[model samples]
Target chain A: MSEKTDIGRELDGALQKPKRQLAMVFDLNKCLGCHTCSISCKRQWTRDEGMDNMWWAVVNTQPGKGTPKNWEDMGGGWDEKGEPRPSKIPTRDEFGDAWKFNKEEVFHGGKGKVTYLKPVNTKGESPDWGPNWDEDEGGGEYPNSHFFYLPRICNHCTHPACLEACPRGAIYKRDQDGIVLINDKQCKGFRFCMEACPYKRIYYNHVQDVTQKCIFCFPRVEKGVAPSCARQCPGRLRFVGYLDDEDGPIHKLVHQWKVALPLHEEYGTQPNVYYVPPMSPPAVDSLGKVDPSKPRIPTAYLESLFGPRVKEVLAVLEAEKEKKAKGEASELMDTLIVYKWPEDIFPDFVQDPAEL
Target chain B: MLVKRIDVNGDVLGDPAASVWSTANGETVPLMPTPAAMQPTKYISTKWQNEVYGQTKSVSVKALRNADEIAFRLEWQDPTKNEQRIENTDFPDAVAMQFPLSEDASLFMGGEGTPVNLWYWRADHPARARSDVAHGIGTSRVMDDVSISAQAVHANGRWSVVMRRALSVTKEAASAIQIVPGQTVRTTFAVWEGGNLERAGIKAFSPAWLELEIEA
Candidate 1:
């Protein structure tokens, strides 16, 4: 273990190849609450059997049911003692189905009064829902309801919860570049990783009778190429680099600038992917009673995702906001390199093959 | 040559080069390695390679088990796009696959014609695939993995077709077809549509694509 195995060496050589890890960092503000990411990921990964039900990457419209519906509330990843947490498999309706036209109605009845339109199940069965059915769709009244997209995938963690949960040691974290992968040959399909994962990114391939997850594209990374999804993104929101690269954006965001924060940091998985939490609009007076002009990014919402430490971070952010408002630059985001559109900041991925 | 002599020593089938008519005489023809090679690749944990002979230009070889499948990564390229084929008047175009049976030897070549389904698999013997022919898809086929894709060839000329199979000797097979830029090479394969060594253990016979590797 001390000398790094062949795979470890392979991963080591891959890190400096300049092809990069190819990670997507969605800007919550610009997400538009669209299910484009979910649909794209599904087409690329789950177009085959067993993977029919899988959405390796999903976009959740927050303040609403997340994919695998209620994944956040499941409390997997790791317990206080670091044991794995079990998870519930999502139903077909949960992920949603591909939209279909009522061809039967259209074919037989010309100009039918009521056209039957529904999502078609790949298997010919009428699945109730699909991967993106509920995206941007919430159940609430006007004014109070709110939503934002939370695109998710395997964190490929520094201390992966799923990696530790596999009893057969079928799962491994490559020491060279730290990509957590399941050796399909050794995987028992026990799905311990599925349960151990806090983000519920691992999918049990029923057809293969084994467990599979995001690979971080080892072949491409080793060959100095990026993953398909990251490379093909139409929105340049993806950043491909190493966490250890001090000059890399990931390093600066997670450690140095400390702007990007992990979701539910209390889970203690030390996830590598971090989110720079989006700021929300101020609350409204639903009752027309209590004043609703309070600053958005509600303390409750922030605390729930980032823990109580969010309070201190928000205070600094607000003070900086005040100073900047009065003509003085805020120290909060000053040292931080904020990328912009057509560039890195709020960058859109160029996943559109047609465009290329 | 040791290559022709070796085939004569085994239960030699009909013309080995009949299906190879399109191949150049100088093209490096890959022969089956030692029987022990049925063992999986050390670098690639989920792959198995071997070579076999047969007749005709097309046939179907089926694995005798319920859990094995396959994909052929042919390493080839054509400057003039001459002999390289994209479709055969009757097949879908894409990667090809076959199911493998328990205790059967790994395959050296399986044509890209079977349809792929959720419960699809090859039922041929893993330890003795070469000794006998494989099985054919019956009407009773439940899990569908038998998919033939030679129809998707949009290119007009000789295109490099890697018969990538979703072969399942184990629980799940790694769908590793994403080419890694300059590190990966476009390979070639020879396809035979007919063969008949199918003796006692043999079950079926069909078109097969034998993978060929080239060194610079």
Candidate 2:
């Protein structure tokens, strides 16, 4: 008998197949940039003395300075040689600190402003631009002003740069699910991996002198439960699932419908996480008639990620949104579907041997 | 201290990449050698049965530095003997001839002190050692960088101490120059340090000058 086609074989063995990737999809439009995600994430992983300033998951407002301030500006992921690039070291300010601010003057107002002694960040240090720096501080006057929240975490990558930079071979990615993790016991604290990461998401634990970053909730994920950041989000904007699970939300959001886009795809790390593209109102002249064809998220912004194919992706999303608005497509676009699981959260998972 | 010269002249006994060589010079000269570590990969493994095993060789290197001319004020319990190499009169002459280390003492009170006795290591030499009346030898150094050097002796009477740091540098900050292997690496340093001059744990020799050794 002739061999079955690949698709036919895959169809027959669908239940036996395990997803090779774990990813998250963020709906930037619904993200409040509330530290709830950051706070929940911090409390879960970084509560230790050494892990103090590590905000493995943080939210930054667009058009505002990022966690490492101008993280987008610091260079190092891909080399000019087209070879893999490494991460750069983040300063104490990048991790942020409890800056001494003048509460006395702000309440009293006039006196501090005129005296040139108004509340200011202490020197030899920088001011605390809390996890959320520019939220609600959108530009433009009256009602037309706007800004969006961008919550970020370590993008567990397919070709993880941090993994390559570790000389001690302490950091590793699970072959089964692609979860990036640091082997704390083996880590020598050399921190080369931190410098190699373009995201600047990994942090140095001063007290322990080891390096740490987002683990994609390995323990929870292995049990088939979502991460703390995704589970506790009040906005219900985050979705977590395996990339190969066709029935799962992450698979449908990123591969099936394809609205979710990986941030900075040019880095070529093949980041597992995805984003439900943020939308902004199209630009207009003095009058306020909305342009039907123009997409909310700028095409220029999309180009940075999906490249020339961005127009195609945006077109598809817009079409889906329109169809949903007309009551034709599934109401998925308008509503955030948070999966409710029992107390025993986790997936009945079995890892793959090839990844081992 | 600056590098005096290097002896990167020829072939490494076995694999060329097995080790590196270099040299340096300063207040004290050192004969630095390679870690000289060789693994199975470092040499052509010979097959025993069906498995391959590596051969290893070990060597030791000793370095030499100039010892400060001490006053040799050795006082002992033994009765005065004719074998005494230094006369009691010699110490007075050496002290009188030595430069006066003038210094103001109130530095402890945050006041600037004048120059005084030079900084010196009171450590005893193992091989060339003997106790004085106070159970220690009285030694002194000139207020200048005392030139010192190191040399190595190989197992086969063959020696290879690279011309490490140039011996011309002054002692202050550049005193104990580090010796590293260059292209022509030095072999070992048993001959440089006062070898055969003293025995261990017994000799109470004190160096008026101190030299340091480092590993690469």
* Per-residue C-alpha lDDT of model 2 across residues A1-356, encoded as one tens digit per residue: 11221101122245222237677788776887677989888888889876666788988776566777777766545554435453346665655643455556654765655554332232334465654565667555433455677788998876666776554557887777778899887664545566667777778775565788999878766665568887777887877766767666666677667778777766655566677766667755457766656544456754664456667666676677788778785535633344443221123222322343
Model 1 over residues B1-216: C-alpha lDDT tens digits? 011111121111122222331221223333222222222212111111122422222222211101122222122221122221111111111112332332232333221332222121121111111111122211112222233221111133222332222222232222122222122222212232211211111122222322222111
Name the regions of candidate 2 deviating beyond 4 angstroms: A1-19, A79-82, A100-130, A138-144, A293-297, A331-356, B1-216
Predicted model with the maximum lDDT? 2
Q: Where is model 1 more than 4 Å wrong at Cα?
A: A1-26, A97-115, A120-127, A137-142, A218-220, A223-240, A286-293, A318-356, B1-216
Please give each candidate's TM-score: 0.52, 0.54
RMSD of each: 16.9, 21.6
Chain B TM-score, candidates in order: 0.22, 0.17
lDDT per model vs. reference: 0.43, 0.47
Q: How far is candidate 1 from the true structure (C-alpha RMSD, Å)?
A: 16.9
